[model samples]
Target: MQRFTVTLVWVCFTLATFPAQAEELALTSTRTLAASCAACHGPNGNSLGSTPTLAALNQQYFIQRMQGFKDGSVSSTVMHHHAKGLTTEEVTAMAAYFAQQPRQTPQPLPHQSFLGAQ
Candidate 1:
């Protein structure tokens, strides 16, 4: 009876940790996915140029814009192609991730040239 009680307790304890593990895994996956946007959107979605910042954006708005891009409703020079490649789940995850980030102004790059002229 004691052995059975010990096993039950161990099983319960193990099961109790599964949700935390799953949450951690989800967060890691989301972060990995969000990292891909850093190239154009700047780190944590703070844009450094003319590109619109994604940080602290409304989640639903983000999802809608991405969906619009995917469906050809939004015109873009590059976003449509990028948006088309993302699954709905990926878009949602990215939206949620961006929404949670605090928005910050990006500093201008040193010695930046305009119109390709030095």
Candidate 2:
């Protein structure tokens, strides 16, 4: 009986020291939510077009824009529909996630001299 009690305590202690598996579920959820933005915003929010990039955007700005979209205070062509379904927690998570990504600055177009230029 003494040996069994010690073994049970050891097992419980080992399990408690290890990280919980629930972390993976949280990562999966964040990934799933971010994927929804890839179509227009580019993968991981590094947009390669006219759309504003979400990567490295200020957290407060991101939240404000998202909340605006959700509340219909921000005018957008499509974001309103997308933002409508997100919970506040999800928005914060997404903002933090995207803010960690590296932002890509768009390059300026090359200057072309007119045919009449000297």
Candidate 3:
């Protein structure tokens, strides 16, 4: 009984000291890192961007996009540059950050928005 109790106690202590599955930045840190990104990505992931706004996207979708960027499937001069530098952990954090942000409401087109123009 005494040996069993010591073993259990050590096991618990070791588990407590174990590292994370992967490093993940806190949301606050992600936000701080995102300040520069906000210049183009927009505050809270809502960009004043002429390209596309990325605010409030699903976490999975955001992760897919980041992975795409990392794989060179996604095209963007700036995104490529930035994405290349992101560690997988950082990418996950950034994705989580944007996922938590509010999405921007899309504006209706004034003219006919056609799928195809003849």
- For TM-score, the strongest prediction is 1
Query: Which candidate number would show the highest lDDT if scored against the true structure?
Result: 1
In candidate 1, residue 76 scores what lDDT?
A: 85
Positional deviation of 50 in candidate 1, in angstroms?
A: 1.0
Positional deviation of residue 89's Cα in model 2 after best superposition, in angstroms: 1.2
Clashing pairs in 3: none
For model 1, residues 1-118, the per-residue Cα lDDT tens digits are: 9999999999999899999999999999999999889999998999888888999999999999999999988888899999999899999999999999999977777774577655
| Regions of model 2 farther than 4 Å from truth | 1-19, 105-118
Where model 3 places Cα greater than 4 Å from the true spot, the runs are 1-25, 104-118
Clash numbers, per candidate: 0, 0, 0
Q: Estimate each model's TM-score.
A: 0.85, 0.73, 0.61
Q: Which parts of model 1 are misplaced by more than 4 Å?
A: 107-118
lDDT of 2 by residue, 1-118 (tens): 9999999999998787655556667777887888789789987797878998888899999999999999989999988988898899999988888888887664565788798957
lDDT of each: 0.93, 0.86, 0.73
Angstrom error at residue 118, model 3: 52
